[model samples]
Target chain A: MVYELYYWPGIQGRGEFVRLALEEGGAKYIDIALKPENRGGGVPAMNKFLEGPRVPHPPFAPPFLKVGKQLIGQTSNILLYLGGPLKLAPRDEAGKLWVHQLQLTVADLVVEAHDTHHPIAAGLYYKDQKAAAKRRAEDFREHRIPKFFNYFEKVLTRNRTAGPWLVGRRVTYADLSLAQVVAGIRYAFPKASTKALRKHPRLMKLHDAVFERPRIKRYAESGRRLAFNNDDLFRNYPELDG
Target chain B: MVYELYYWPGIQGRGEFVRLALEEGGAKYIDIALKPENRGGGVPAMNKFLEGPRVPHPPFAPPFLKVGKQLIGQTSNILLYLGGPLKLAPRDEAGKLWVHQLQLTVADLVVEAHDTHHPIAAGLYYKDQKAAAKRRAEDFREHRIPKFFNYFEKVLTRNRTAGPWLVGRRVTYADLSLAQVVAGIRYAFPKASTKALRKHPRLMKLHDAVFERPRIKRYAESGRRLAFNNDDLFRNYPELDG
Candidate 1:
């Protein structure tokens, strides 16, 4: 069955996390919001599912995956649902929960990353909160990024059962997500990210290995892959990079 | 099995979310962090798991549950695991995912509520970033709270099968979490929360019902329930409320 992904078009945002999993999992899915409006797509199409009275389980936000009649929302929740079906997560109950726990941690880091640019308010433009953003970014660069990276690096180092993957010997959705986050941070904060990467060789190795995989490499080179821009979660503001 | 919960002492922070579930679920559990450190409890016991090399799966932060040898981290993840055994979640797969989706949304709202006072940095004192906190609190009061409350209210109103609960007719972990968040927000932003609650009667009903439940009410008045203070996630800052 083909899965339908509903998210805002143009920017990667949270939806990109689902997209990475879908690509690596090799699931048959359509990016619903990217299609033209006449063919039942775009933000209007996405909003219909959200606002329509017929939907019993309406999502709080996008990055939701629609499998048949089921609509799964929240990036981590969507990944959890798709993990087993796509063979991207462990078959055991305990392993799946561990991978999901790691994903949630990544989600937290992502929120902090986004907040660096919009420290005062998500509704307000970055320019309006530029001063506050600068302060937030400084703390994020100096503290948060290293703290998160160090945790992941330790997790990787402590994985005796698995050679390099987060959970087991095989790659999981968490690995793909960490790779994406690392790439995004590098783009957003080149100097700081580079410094942090030097301290986290294991994490860097996992990030590099994830992209080198055939399925992921093809997706990365594919025209469908969106470029990192100011509109996305990870923006290139040199001043914020410290 | 007697489950052990580890978290920071003296605050009803994220740990309270887990405590509410454990209490309502009628599970036998120990509040390890609140226990005497001499008996393998308190912050030292909790830190041992975090910093120990023997732990295969280390949680990034607390509100972690130790069941036998397995440790589950992330508040939502812990609830997701306990939801089934304690009968706080739906048995069916679709229903479980839906409830979890709702829980994740509640988690997002909790983060924003905490950020009202720590918009600049979590590590920095609120007094240092009072100016930025004021700006962030304004947007949270005017935009974020209403958006989240409206979404939950709509979810409650649209839950045809479940009636008033977030999911099915039976109380789920999401409902308990929502109730906690609503109470926290009321403490943090009295004026804004009151205004938002006025518009969402359905949500307030759910919140009230959750606290009014026999087990929850017993726990509420058992003297174990911690008071909301400045040290907690939801602080009562009069200046930030407006």
Candidate 2:
């Protein structure tokens, strides 16, 4: 069965994590929001599961995946479901949890990165909370980014496997997600990310390695992979960037 | 085997979520941070996992559970790991994912609630960011709280099973987490949470029901359950309350 991904159109946002994994896994899936209206696409089609009274498991927000009749919500949760099936996660229970743990950490980092631009409120525009955004972004760039990057670098350093992957030797969804987060943060804060990442060679190598994968590289160059924009989570606000 | 929990000693914080589930499950576990220094408890003990160079799966932060040799990090991940063995989650895969999705949503709400006070930076003092906190709290009280509470209430309303729980007729970890979130939010923003919760009776009832469980009630009344304070994620700042 083809996986149906429901997310806001025009921006990669959180859905990009799932898209990247799906692309690498060679899974048949449809970006529901990007499809034409008649074929069951657009915001309204996605909203039906959210707004529909009968929906068994209504997602609170976008970036949900519909597999068969099940609607999996939350970015990390969606990745957890797809990880095993898509062969991007470990087969053992402990290994799977470890990969999922890493993904959840990436999720945490993403939330913090998003908040750097929209500190006060997601509903409020960045312009409305630019002052708070500046302060938040400063802390994010100086303290948070280094701390997170250091943690990931350490994880890669501690991996006993011969390969550069976070868990065992082969690539996991966590690696893909970590690369996405790195790319997004770098896009949002080129100067700050560059300096912070300077101390994280393993993380940088992993980021480049993930993107260099054949499927991921093709998908990245493919017109379907949306470019980073102000409207997305990782907005490149010059003033917010150090 | 007794589960070893590693978190800061003073605050209920995220560890409380895991504690509640352990209590409800009647599982053997130790609050490692609360124990005396001689018995391998306290902040240093918790820090070893985080700071140690050889830790295989280093947790990004505390509230990690050590079951045997494996260290499970992330509150939701810890709950997800425990949910099955503790019999607090569903037996089926889809049911488990649905419950986990709900827990992740609660996790998102908790972050937003915490940010209402520290909109600028978690490392910064609340007093330093009081102006931004006020603005963030206002939006949280007026918009975020109601939206989250309403979404949860909708989940309870749509649970096809004839029960008060979010999944089937049994109480899942998501129900426990949702209750904890409501209680924490109510403590943080009494005025706002009370007002927002008024529009969602099912959520209010669910919160009350989860706390009223015999094990949960006993554990909560026990001094073991730390009192809500400013140092915790949910702080009762009257000025920040609507």
Candidate 3:
């Protein structure tokens, strides 16, 4: 059965991490919220999942995946579960744990990225919290971007077996996650990411390498890989960037 | 061998979650940074782990537990690992996963709690970002607190077993973590939590039950349990709470 992925339709958001893995692995899946009849052409299905009582273990929010009877939420947990089946994770327990750790870190970075635009409240409009968002964006660009990017770069450099992939020779979920992060940063803060990439050669190479992968290339060009915009985590706010 | 816990000495911070589990289970462990000759104390140890030579899998941040040679970080991951040996988690996979999901939700709340104070940057002083922090804190108190508390309340209400524990008929990490969250909320937003508790009877019952547990009672009474202060995740700011 195809995995049912439930997330916001338009932007890649957190769901993109899961989507990339499924896309690159060529897994059979359906982006449920994007479908018309399934969701009644809106986010009601996603809302129903959140408010519904049928799920014994209900997800707190979206970007959740349904595999058979099991419903898994939390972006990192979803990736961890899919990693083995999709061949996006290492075989060994230690390596698998490492991949999960990397994914969790990526999740952390993603949260920080989102906070750059909506520091005050997720429910509030960006215009309502512009001042706070501006301050948060500055901190993100100055501290968080460098801190997270440098850490990933170090991991890439430190990996003795594979210089590019986060864990081993295989392209695990971490690799796909890194690629998306790089792409988001470039779209959001072109100048900062360009300057940051110079210090992290291996990370830059990995970002370039992921795009060259046949499946990933197809996914990127298929229009399914949504472009980063002001609506997503990596918003290109000129004032926030500098 | 005793488990090695590495976190800053003063505040309960994130390390408190691990500390509570260890205390309840009566696990043999040492809070590394609290001891003398600890090689420049907790801050140094934390920074070293973060900025030091890259391990095969680097932890994003501290509150990591070292059992033998394996170094595990991330609060939920550490709790999940310790939960088994400490008898703080369910033996069954499904139960374990549920508890983990609950713990991850707790981690999310903890992040939001931290953001209330340090909305702009972890590196910046709270005073420097007080304006932004005020707005962020308002949203947290008004929106996040109720959202998280209500979700957990529903989980407690939905448990068919009628058990106080989140999973089965036993106290798992979720129960302990929930107790801590309750305590933190009470400290941080006494007025708000008092009002909110009226609507969440099951959660309050669980909190009351956890407080009566022998080990937890001892831990709370002992000088070891750090008091809630401005330094911790849940802090008192009258303006923010209102």
Candidate 4:
């Protein structure tokens, strides 16, 4: 059976991680929220799980996955569920834990990236919090971008035995997610990300390699693939970027 | 062999969640960073695993668990590892995933609580970002606290078959973490938390019940249980609180 994936139609947000993995794995799944509400999908269908009585395991928020009878939520958690079957993680217990650790760190960076524009509140508009956003974005683009990239770069450098992959020789979900991070950073802070990448060739190389993977490359060109925009988690505001 | 848990000595931070599990389970483990440096068990010992040559599995940060030769990081990841052995998680796969989902949500709240005082960056001091923090804290206190609690409250109400615990009648690591989250919030935003708790009796009762557990109670009063302070994730900044 084709799995069901639910997320906001307009933004990649956390859902893109799951979508990338699914796309890479060529996994049979439906992007439920991307469908029209008239077809019994989209935000209204997703809300049923949020507010409906039948959903004993209602997600705190979306990008939730429905595999058979199970409903899984949380980006990292969902990635974990997909990683095994998708071969996006290692087979060993230790490797799984390590990959998960890397993924969790990626998640940490993702949240910080989101906070750059929405430092005060996710509910408020960027204009309302521009002052705070400026400071937050600077801190993010400066201290955080380097720190996180440095950490990943270190992880990549240290794991030579496993090749260029974050955890192993194989392209796991972490690499795919890293590709997204790099793209998001470049899109949102072109100048700063360009400056940051100038000294981090290994990171740039990994992002390029992940993007070039046949399935991912094909998906990127596919009409199903959405472009990064102001409405998404990684919004490009000229004033906010360094 | 006993597990070797490493974290910064000064703060409860993320390590406290792991500490509570080991303490409650009466598990044989050494809180490495908490020990005196003279005995080769302080930050130096922890740093070895982080930066030293001996560690093939260097952690990004502390609160890592070393079991035999394996190293695990991330609070929720470590708990997910310890849950089964500690009998703090359900036996079924679905139940375990559900428990983990709850734990991740608690982690989300923990990060938000920390950000209330340091919204600009963790690299920056609270005083440096007080203006942003006040705004962030107000948002957290007014919007996030209720939204998060309301979701959990709904989960608790929905999962009545499991009894009072978040996952089931059994107290999982999530409950322990929830207990910590409550304590941290109360310590940081006593007035706001008090007001919030007035409307969240179920959450308050869960917090109290977890704290009152014989093992947890003994551990809390033990001298090893550090008091919440400014250095910790949840600091009582009067200006930031509602």
Query: What is the overall TM-score of model 4 with all chains considered together?
Result: 0.97
| Candidate 1 wrongly placed segments (more than 4 Å) | none
How does each model score on TM-score? 0.99, 0.99, 0.94, 0.97
* Error in Å for residue B72 of model 3: 1.2
Model 3 earns a TM-score of 0.94
Instruction: Report the candidate with higher lDDT, 3 versus 4.
Output: 4
Docking class of 1: high
User: Model 3, range B36-69, lDDT digits (tens) per residue?
Assistant: 7556555676566767785555677887877787
Could you tell me which residue pairs clash in candidate 4? none
Candidate 3, DockQ score (0 to 1): 0.59
lDDT measured at residue A218 in model 1 versus the true structure, 0 to 100: 94
Per-residue lDDT for A1-242 in model 2, tens only?
Answer: 89999999999999999999999999999999999889889998999998998897899999999998889999999989988889999899999999999999999999999999888888998889999899999999889999999999999999988877899989999999999999999999999989888899999999999999999999888888999998998999999886
lDDT of 4 at B221: 86
Predicted complexes: DockQ each: 0.88, 0.92, 0.59, 0.73
Q: What is the C-alpha lDDT of each candidate?
A: 0.93, 0.91, 0.83, 0.88
Report the candidate with higher lDDT, 1 versus 3.
1
Give candidate 4's error at residue A154 in angstroms. 1.0
lDDT of each residue in B22-115, candidate 4, tens digit only: 8888899999987898998888998888887546667788789999989999999999899988889998978888888889999999999999
Task: State which candidate has the highest DockQ.
Answer: 2
> Candidate 4: global Cα-lDDT?
0.88
